[model samples]
Target: MSSPVKQTLKWAQKLLPACDGDLNHAKRQLVWLKEKIISDRPGGAIDDKLSEQEQTQLEKYINQRVFDHKPLQYILGTQPFCDLDIVTRPPILIPRWETEEWTYKVIQLMHQHLDKSRPLRILDICTGSGCIALALAKHLPKDSAQIIGLDISNKAISLANHNLNIHKLSIRNTVEFREKDVFNLDLKEPVDMIVSNPPYITHDEYNSLDPDVKEWEDPRALVADEQGTRIHKRIIQVAKHCRPYNNDLPRLIMEVGGTHQIKPLTEEMQINGLKDIEVWKDLADKDRVIVAH
Candidate 1:
């Protein structure tokens, strides 16, 4: 036990340079890697420790890839969003802290304004990892809200379903995962709300992303044409097709790029006939989510 711990500590020391000399960050990655190796074992026993050979293999694994600045969520295959442990994998955008922050705020607003007696239907477009959808399930009334998480990647849908089941969210039955291109989405009924953290990174910005993201994460899930507002425009255009429920305008909440996205996105929402448009900033006070009816 001490041998493996000592070995990983040495490995962490060697990896510290790649973590910007942050010893804590390097140690956290070591711990995460150990957890991953153990969880892959039968029954996932917590007391199970690695053998000398296994520790050597783990060291090689970290040295080869993860310490080279790969996103830690992809390395560990999970991320915490709200109170749920969401499954994370490649080709699906990992849940961002900013997205989680705004999602909780949206849920709070829904609780205050939405009719609790009636069922609430929510559509989550580009629902990578299903973090936003599952977060809503964990928070909203399990008996009332029906959430659908749509992503173009089948892998993302599968991972989202895995997250939904693993977390044991009581609302899992009502939370559905589907593979659909948001650009061509056509709903049969108008949902109470539509929320998305779609691909909003501009092409130029995508080119300049960190190698950790550029090499490991999915480009299709990140970059958009036309200054990152192309998909945002499509989302707004499709809003005209959805019918409003309960004599109230259907709610639209979407995560945007930055302050640069505010003016054009708001104008696009208004042109698409959405009303009551507003911008919500993230923790950094950067404009992040656009809320409209």
Candidate 2:
């Protein structure tokens, strides 16, 4: 008889023709569902058996996946980011590996360079689920950083607060979530750093993305005008207007689209008087993040 893993994966893929239809993604979801719902162990010779009830539940989930084209993360209702179990919700962008990787890097840089003798204030704009802010609060030197997470959606704020409360016991600093529009945002106090994983996907690009993303994720959290540089410019303007923090702190650390975004964003930062622009590429060697102070 075929291994249970193989059998289930085959069944899952057959049901996904109406969905993303990517075998690899289906396999991943299959394994994750098995591990989570059935308590099956990963790796090695797979021998876990599913009970009738379990099989029924899995079928229901697979049906949802195929018929609704819903993302697995949405079905499971959580995403792991920066070692934190971030809550995922519909219409709100889920945390991606890219965001997690860069957030960890930013935390490390902040730990090494930020002047922790005094309080440090950081803003995470368009912060869906508050993953960045929560992760920073969890890993960064606690009790000294006041991280604020801002989003334009009320549901986003509610979900972000829910995620924060889930980990509030371990996080010792102040992390607040608010629903505010970035375009009309006005801040009085200067901040040490501003980090964002804004919507930079172009309309055309968004159209071509996987159904799991195009169908489920909020377009406002993924698409921007001006060829994906609209929100980036507004963020740059925010960084430009903020007075420089005292001595050796990054003013802006923002995730951007691949290589095409770097030059123009760097120029925008220069024109706005922000210096020390640095491009941080992802493991694929494509420019993924831009930093300036």
Candidate 3:
């Protein structure tokens, strides 16, 4: 009978091979499983002295699934995104660190340019887990900003609402999660900014996604037509048309696929009359965010 921590560590080491040597991911899965068992206790504290039956049940529940490459975030049912606990479930694309990094950048940029006194409305398209929208609401001035998270999946919208309630118990800000396809959006009120992390994986590329992604995530939320550039192009065109008649167009910021995507996406935005188009790289130095004014 090994201590629970030691037992979990041992299992994590064995899981490392299946995770492509990702020790952190393996350990995170173990921790998530451990937390679930101890969740009812105050502070969600862990006890190393798990009874033999408890240890057996825990191992049986998670070990094989982890070995088969299910994403830890989905298994845990939550992912941390820019200080928000984004609830993740099946078919909703898990929030990535790259998106988190650039989302913060967008927030910082907005603070620098937008008038703090004026109320700001921002639309989040393809807001899978409401990670980006909720993060903005939590960080920005509660009284000055209105955020809407739009998604095509009803399940995602439900989960987003649950996540908002969990993470924003004392909600001082306005954040709405709605089921709306980005392809067919009609905004009654003009927004000051628009942001998204839309699907950009091409059909061919989708076949190459990791088993964890291919098996567990939603294809509609992962694949796009035309070499993964379709949704991005549509968003640019739609944003152009949805611009407020009396004011300058809403500032657009989006997460793109890669360095190759930056040129083509920026070009599409330029064709749609968007100005001040800029490409930003993630921490890995890979082109990740495209900003257009």
What does each candidate score in C-alpha RMSD? Answer: 2.8, 3.9, 2.8
After aligning candidate 1 to the native by TM-score, how far in Å is the CA of 92 from where it should be?
Answer: 1.5
Model 2's alpha-carbon lDDT is: 0.85
How many clashing pairs in candidate 3?
A: 0
TM-score of model 2 (CA atoms): 0.89
- For 58-112, candidate 3 gives per-residue lDDT tens digits of 6664665656676777666678888877888988889999999988887786566
The TM-score-based order of candidates, best leading, equals 2, 3, 1
Weakest 10 consecutive residues of candidate 3 by summed lDDT: 241-250
Q: Which pairs of residues collide in candidate 3?
A: none
Q: Per-residue alpha-carbon lDDT of model 2 for 1-293, expressed as tens digits?
A: 77776777676676667445677766777767766665433344355577677777788777877877888888888999988899999999989998888999988887778674677888999899999999999998867688999999999999999999899998878999989998989887767789999999887898799888888998899999888999999999888776566656678999998888888899999999999899998877879999998
The sequence of per-residue lDDT tens digits that candidate 1 reaches over residues 1-293 is 35756766787887786577898988887787777878776666676568666677677767755456667787777888988878788767888899999988977876676675677888898998999998888887656688889999888889988988887645533788999998778878667778899899998898788887888788988988889989888888776565565545347889999989889988988888888888888889898988888
What TM-score against the true fold does each predicted structure earn?
0.88, 0.89, 0.89
Model 1 bad stretches (over 4 Å): 1-9, 38-50, 66-69, 243-250
In order of lDDT, best first, we have: 2, 1, 3
Candidate 1 weakest lDDT stretch, 10 residues: 241-250
